[model samples]
Structures are given as C-alpha cells and as structure tokens.
Target: MADETPPVDEMLYEQLAQDALRGVIRSALERAALPAGIPGAHHFYVTFKTRAPGVSVPPDIMAKYPDEMTVVLQHQYWDLTVEATRFSVMLKFGGMPKVLSMPYTAVTRFYDPSVQFLLQFEAPATIEEIAVEIAAMPPAEVEPLGGDDAPKVVSLDQFRKK
Candidate 1:
C-alpha cells in the first residue's frame, strides 16, 4: 500500500554503516580466532584515535601518536584477540610490546592491504564520546547488496516455494 522505507538520515545512517563496517573487522578477527592466529594472506592497517575510550597504550606510543595512529597487523603482532565488543592486540613501537584495547567506534579507518578494500568512518561528535559509543551501541546491521531491489535478471525461484 505504501513505500515506507524511511528516508535515510545521512548522519545516523553513517553511524550504522560504520558499525556494519566494523563487523567486517570482527568477522575477520573471528576467523583468525578459529586458527588461533592470523590467516590466509589477511592483514590489517587499523587506524584509531589514541585518545579514544577503552584505548590503552604505553606512554611512548601516546607521545608518538598524540592524536591518531595506524598499526599494521602483519608479520608482527601478538595476542591478537578479538571479541564481539572490542579487539585487543599487542604491538611494538620501538621493539617494545605495548597492549592496546580499542573499541570499534574508536576505529576511524580500516584497510586490508591484502584485498585492497577500505572503510572509513566519520569522526564522532566529540573525541570524548567515542569510547562511550563503542562500549554502548550494539553492532549495526549489515546491508545486503543489490540495494533495495534485485537486479533486472529474471530467473526462476531456486526455492520455488519448496
């Protein structure tokens, strides 16, 4: 009777999109968890706000990356534990291992050099709000491809109502 998909609020939708984007990271890490290590030519360049919430880094890392920092996840990284809410990893800045706890919301950008796909999220309203949102907001929905409607390919139903 009515086409009632509400108009997208770009801002809110962006948040949702970003949340979904992090799901990709989550899934990748989850898969890694299966084998108990990084797998299958997959690596990440994760850039996050050092000052973001739930983020813990050594003093030296903070001093070097006062604002934002990008860490590589290839050939070098340890204790790469990823959970539903947040992922923790041990990385070295100057041959010294440092632990970092980062919420997905704190992640401003994620790049996988293996596949060459990247996702970038807009800055949260305030640097102060990042940690809160990352800890609070549930993971956003993953949108299906082909948009709202399927492509023009006319095909028989695979299920055919069984």
Candidate 2:
C-alpha cells in the first residue's frame, strides 16, 4: 500500500501564526474599548517598539524609552481606540496625559499578569527596516553589538509536543 499524505504548501506558516497571535491583542483591545471595559480583573501589559514605523508617542516618551516601552491598560487609561492595523490610547505620565499610537506589528509582548498568560514576539523589523531606522537616528545613538551578545526571542515551539 502507498502512503497517501499530502505535501505541505509553500505558505509561510510562521507569519500566519504570528498574525493570529496578534489578533488576540486586537480582540482584547476591542473588548476594552467598549463601555464595560476590560471585563472582570483582566488587564494587559502591552510592550512595543518605540522606534518602529507607525508608532507615535510624546517626544519625551520617545526620548526616555528609545528602544521599547510597555503600557498598562488598566484603571488610569482612557480614549482607547483599536483599529485593524493600529490602536491608540491616552495614558498619564508624570501627571501629564500623553497619547500613544502604534501599529499592532510593533508590539513585541502582551501579558495578562492577572492570569499569568504571556505572549512574546520577535522584533518585527526586517534588515532593511532596521537599516533605515538606524540611519534616521542621530549618530550618537547608533551603537553596534556583537551577534552573540544581541538579545534573542524565545520560542515556545521547543516546549510543544512534536
């Protein structure tokens, strides 16, 4: 008897999985945008790349966290809006309110500490994107790191059953 397994298509499954995971963030934000707000004790810690394209934050905030920043979606936030590609919300810092707008692709981490659920993502910038960002930055801020010393994205695949 001949084996009858179908071959996998050439689709990028990793990208597909990433998109689905990001949809979870979008869905959560959509829920939070409603009048009921965030539902029960559920809250989120959303971390994103400060320098990623389409991310908009106050100048002081960009200066302070040039690499990445995490914002908590809890009692103090307001004006939360979630769109297909991006989301924005007003959050207070140092007694002043600032609005942060960012594309979902910029997000690298999403955590719900109340449930201890966490999702981490790889830096979404491509080589060309990274180059463009580095070139746009001031000379003083661009520093090189050895490959081995660079940060890594931890994958859950290793823990999954084959």
Candidate 3:
C-alpha cells in the first residue's frame, strides 16, 4: 500500500481560539452593561447571523433581514444584558422598539469605531444551510454615532482561506 499521511484535523484549535476571542466580546459587553455604561468614547457595532441557532428577534425584523444584521450599541440602546453565552438588548427601529437576543456563537463581527478596533469571525456553517443570496440583499444603513467619521467595515472574506 502507498504510504499516505492521515489528515490532521485542526478544528479543535480553531474552535478554542474562536471561543477565546468570543470571550473578549463578552468581557467588553459586560463592562458596558455596568451602570456607567460604555466608557470614554467606547461603543460597539455588532453583526450577527439572524438565523443562528440561539438568536431571537421579532419575526418582521427576521424577515426583513433574513441572513444577517448589524446593531449599534452607542447611544439609543437600552436594557443591555450580557450573560455567559448570550446577550439581549432593547433597540429602536423606525420609532418602534425591539429586543434582540444573540448568542456569542452567532456574532460574526464586533467593532468599535472610537478606537478603530475590529474583530471578525468565520460564519458558522449554519449560514450555508440557509439558501438565501446574502450578497444580493441591500446593506443596512446605521446612523452615525455623534461623529461625521464612518467606521471602516471589514469583510471577513478577506481573511478566509481559499
């Protein structure tokens, strides 16, 4: 028999690293959830998979944003609660209020324009399970957070290995 090297799976290492990075998001959100709120020019723009396993949102919003959605935690958000595996917050959309619950595993990006900090994650396989043409959807516009400066939006695609 021809000698062939068995394929080594690196999934465990990748999972561990992703979990550790998610902890960073959790820690920052926990700090922001404090009475003082996000301090000293810090804010977050979180992008998550709308249909992820543990995600919950209003049916209409889910329908409007079938594949993915981004949320801002700058000034108008309320009831920000962070837990070990997930977070829930109240936000307004078109003069209507909505609560969103998201697990860390659902998050694909976390960014803070104030410090130009950004983190991007690999989209969970479930994203592929849904057959929506995500790229065809129009981008959601978010109001600027007290500045004329626009945050750089990084596409996770650049980091993916072909």
Candidate 4:
C-alpha cells in the first residue's frame, strides 16, 4: 500500500514560528517595563542585525559592530519601549548613552542567562514593510557599569551559518 501522507502546503510555518517567538521577547520586555523593573535577577541579552532595516544606532558604534551586536539589559538601560513590531531602549557604551531602535524581525537571538533560556530565529530576507521612525531622545545620565557587570559583547559569528 502506498503512503497516504500529503505534501505540506506552503503555509509558511517557519515565518509563523519566528513571529511567535518574537512575541515572547516582546512579552518579556513588556514585563520588564513595569515600574518595579526586570523582576529579581532576570535580564536579557538581545543579539540583533546591526545593519538590518529599521535599526538605529550611533554612527560610530554602527561602524564598530557593522554586522551584529549583543546588548545586556541587566542594568543601566532606560526608556525601554516595546511596540507591536519593534522595541527601543537607551543603553550606554563608553559612558555615552545611545538609543537603539530595532524591529523584531532584526533580532536573531534572545537569551536570558538567569533562566538559561534561549531563542534563535532567522532574520527576514527583506524588511521593507517594517517602517519605523527613529525618534531622538534627550541624552540622559546612565550609571557607569563596573568591570564585572559591563556588557560582554562578543562576536556572534560562531552562532551563524557560513
């Protein structure tokens, strides 16, 4: 007897899964946005495509991390606003504060070290549909990070396929 299984239709399950996972990231950030702040020791390390559409970072910093950058949200991050398609936050690098705005489609990895949870997704082939306006925010003082607590930004190339 022949197998009765039918070929899967082009339902775009992969894109669906990616969207759902990004939703998780959004939800977590939403919780972190509460007045109490990222409850307890919980924090996030978000890795995203620096050159991806709708991503806005300082010019020099963009030149430094032209490919991808990982930011730690443990402390000294402010004005975290989570929107339907993207999120923006202010983080300090070298004692200079900068606001980064990126669409969820630009995020390649989201990890919570405290819980050892991880989510990796393929960035969209094209992000022309994601229109985001980069708003300038007044520079605010952010506490300097200590040596041990500073963001450990390493190349995420190893995690990517050649």
Candidate 3 vs candidate 4: the lDDT winner is 3
Candidate 1 runs further than 4 Å off: 1-11, 125-162
Candidate 3: where is the Cα deviation over 4 Å?
1-11, 127-162
TM-score, one value per model:
0.66, 0.74, 0.74, 0.72
lDDT of 2: 0.85
Query: For candidate 4, what is the lDDT?
Result: 0.81
Tens digits of lDDT, candidate 3, 42-143: 999999999887899999999999999999998788999999999999999898999999899899999999999999998764554543545654675755
lDDT minimum window of 10 residues, candidate 3: 153-162
Writing each residue's lDDT as its tens digit, candidate 4 over 24-109 gives 99999999887888988899999998888778989988899988899999878999999999999999989988999999988999
Question: What is the per-residue lDDT of model 1 for residues 1-162, given as tens digits with 9 covering 90 to 100?
Answer: 978997767567655676788898898777765655677788888888888656777888889888799988877777878888799988777777889888887788889889898988764333455445456755645456767855444233331211
What is the clash count for each candidate, in the order shown? Answer: 0, 0, 0, 0
Model 4 stretches astray by more than 4 angstroms: 1-8, 126-162
* Best-matching candidate per lDDT: 3
Task: For candidate 2, list the clashing residue pairs, or say none.
Answer: none
Ranking by lDDT: 3, 2, 4, 1
lDDT of 2 by residue, 1-93 (tens): 999999775686877898899999999999999998998899999999888878898999989998899999988899999999999999999
